[model samples]
Target: MARPQYILQPVNPYFIAFSLAAAFLLNLLPWGKLPGIPDFVALVLLFWNIHQPRKVGMGIAFFLGLLMDVHNASLLGEHALAYTLLSYGAITIHRRVLWMSLGVQAFAVMPVLVGTQLVPFVTRLLMGASFPGWDYLVSGFVAAVLWPIASVVLLLPQRRPVDPDDTRPI
Candidate 1:
């Protein structure tokens, strides 16, 4: 399958940190609880977890989750638990994910994305919060839809230049 580009160099740790911070900032924007607004943090976390598990592991996921929890001011560990689980799922399948085409990769990771949302949803319900309806899952689907875009953007820094000769790649 054709990829956006192959990585020719090691991914920089700083870029990973920047991407996570940017995603968190995106989440901080006042969307006023829109049902379909995707969770930018979760999306980016999953991307990095899958693509660079060593650099962005569950610890970072938990830390970011804590920040999210504080910002949302919901139950203390909701986002942390969710993001950790998401990271675990991604890391487990990272190798397989890298081989698949972007479109298939999105579908492959859909469950992890949606399940990440599920953690907080279930927690809220267990604590007597009202059912948020099925729209809660919409963001996961949206994130999956954006999978290809995220992969391309995140991989840009690590991409190799294509060879001038058509026979050789990267």
Candidate 2:
């Protein structure tokens, strides 16, 4: 028997909204002074890029990044640029990264996540703002560390195979 085809379908708008809301919630979580915790937004973008690249692409990432800029009261477009670039990079590497084991993906994604954060950090510095300190990169580190966990959680909904014999037609 041939293996089942995994067709790429558009995710429900509700799901996209819920995922963004959850990411914002995670970002707002009061984790004071935690080091190396991955940024929730980056982790979510990575998960979506690997699993549903067709549905959540750079446009969505850029929009979400813009929202973060507004919510966090930061310079406009700082996160927008970072997210756009990161999402592009993730999508470009999605095929290879998706085939790897979770640990490998996590390790591979670290630099992308860090670079996303670092771009904004450096941009702010060039604008004459004092450094936000080394701790500013903590979110990127956290995002990398949380990669495995995020992947597991995001994949949970897809674990159960849909019954082919059901009334629904393919």
Candidate 3:
């Protein structure tokens, strides 16, 4: 049997804003005290970057990273640099990534997320900061694991009735 086809629908800008805000709020939750929690903001941002590159890009990533730095009181530019690179990676292969199944997409994103984490890790190491332990790597894995859930949640708003101009079947 042929696989089902999913039509691409245009996304509302406000919906993107709401999702980003929600992700930031999730990041701000008290879960910081709990180890192994991933960065929801990064995950959401990466999702948008891949699916809606026109709307979210490096500038937004940098700005969000700055906001994160303020929220976490971490070294400035650490996340900015990391997010910038993450955004770049997403934009670079977004088409390829989007073409894959959700499970495979998660696998594709694992390296990019892990690469993002490396920026801060290396920065901290250079500044003589102690290693945050193996658990620090857990966030990337957690984010990778959450990829399919996030993809479905974020894509929900974009999957609407087919547009009349488009002849593609839903």
lDDT on C-alpha atoms for all candidate structures: 0.91, 0.80, 0.89
Question: Which 10-residue span in candidate 1 carries the lowest summed lDDT?
Answer: 1-10
Judged by lDDT, which candidate is best?
A: 1
Q: Show pairs that collide, candidate 1.
A: none
Where model 3 places Cα greater than 4 Å from the true spot, the runs are 162-169
Superposing every Cα of model 2 onto the true structure, what RMSD results? 4.1
lDDT tens digits, residues 9-93, model 1? Answer: 7888899889999999999999997888889999999999988888889999999999999999999999999999999999999
**TM values, all candidates:** 0.91, 0.82, 0.92
Query: When superposed on Cα atoms, how far off is each prediction in RMSD?
Result: 2.5, 4.1, 2.6
Quote the RMSD, in angstroms, for model 3. 2.6
Across 49-159, the per-residue lDDT of candidate 2 in tens digits comes to 877788889999998899889977899999899998899989888898877777889888888899898989998999999977998887787788788988877655554
TM-score of 2: 0.82
Error of 1 at 132 (Å): 1.4
Which residue pairs clash within candidate 2?
A: 36-141, 36-142, 37-142, 37-143, 38-142, 38-143, 39-143
**Pairwise TM-score winner, candidates 1 and 3:** 3
